[model samples]
Target: MAGLVAALIVGVGLWWSSPVSSGDVHRYVTEAARQQQIALNDGSLVELNVSSDLSVKPTAGERRVTLAAGEAHFAVAHAMARPFIVTAAGVSVLAVGTAFSVRLGETGVEVLVTEGRVEVARDPVDAATSGGGRPKLGVGERTLFYATNP
Candidate 1:
């Protein structure tokens, strides 16, 4: 039984090492005058407004995205195996099979979760003033943290 198990493990490792298929997490749309929507392999959809930049990376470990600039709406699909993470400005939002939208600018940041739940973490903009890094965001809520000194 031990020898058989070892052989099986080796076979699985070999199979995993072989070439595998790939899929795009989200499509990149830049400098658009209108709205842009992207459908992902995980059934999630992202809608972007004008003058925006968003990058989606769907991998086995984690489904990551970045809203570099502008506004975007995310309709994340249900996936227990992987979690969805979005980072914009100095803030990071994490979702577990939920839908939400995020808008970031020089003023601050905004996050709205339409379904499921999400976690928001504050970015360390200025340690001297704010004391430390970003704040922790809870589930089923929205918050706007100012970049001002306390």
Candidate 2:
């Protein structure tokens, strides 16, 4: 009985030492001809361009943002244990302590890496499943993603 109790305590301690989970409690939106600067709970900064909409959802071991429209420049805080990911137009961009910009247009999605590195992947399909890793974009690199008509 004492051994079982010890094991339970260790298990709980390990989980507690891990990253704690958080939810999307903050949201920001910009109107036409207007720009806004938002500060997240985790000390990250987001410069929202005109006519942009985004939401921040922090989960266990990861921080997520859903960009519904327009463009934004993000200066993420350094958190190696928790990756920051942005989803726009069915595309995902993962970063850790990076500065980048993402623009969603009617034609396609555009990403610009200003600092650090980021991994980009097309959504709805797991890149890892095909044994192909997601493409990594380094600083000063830019890419455009356009979906093909099936």
Candidate 3:
């Protein structure tokens, strides 16, 4: 019992000494539709869906956002210091100074590249956990990755 207490104390101390994680994981995020302009801390704009949820900011060096279950249009600010990554289901859209829309649904995922270019990566499984962007998609291109043939 004494050893366990000591270990717990040490773990707590170490955790307190460590820096905070980069991203802020927010679920069930929402706002008005007609407005269609959500501002980021860095002056970027994201027009979200009626009731969409996503996570943002994984590290100080980069701006990462996850499309948990809806669609979002991004008007990204030009920041080479921070690359924007939008992960929806099994697909991830990586952009720097681009604008695009990403949607995640029960069928699959779709990415409509409007402005800049982005990479559309596929997942072997029905869900995605960890992987980098691949298979680049340029402007005016739309790519879809099916989860179960729909």
Query: Which number leads on TM-score?
Result: 2
Per-candidate TM vs. native? Answer: 0.67, 0.76, 0.68
lDDT of candidate 3 over 1-150, digit per residue (tens): 999999997887544323234337433355333223567777778877765666666467677787776788998888876777787875777777899998887778999988988766764311122224467778899988887643
Candidate 1, superposed: residue stretches over 4 Å from native: 1-27, 123-140, 147-150
lDDT at 38 for candidate 2?
76
Error of 3 at 107 (Å): 1.2
Tell me the lDDT of candidate 2: 0.80
- Where does model 3 exceed 4 Å of error? 1-23, 26-28, 31-36, 123-133, 148-150
Top candidate, metric lDDT: 2
Score candidate 3 by TM-score against the native: 0.68
List, residue by residue over 35-83, the lDDT tens digit for candidate 2.
8787787889999898787878887767888888899999999987778
Give the better candidate number (2 or 3) by lDDT: 2
- Supply the TM-score for candidate 2: 0.76
Task: For model 3, name the residue pairs that clash.
Answer: 22-58, 23-57, 23-58
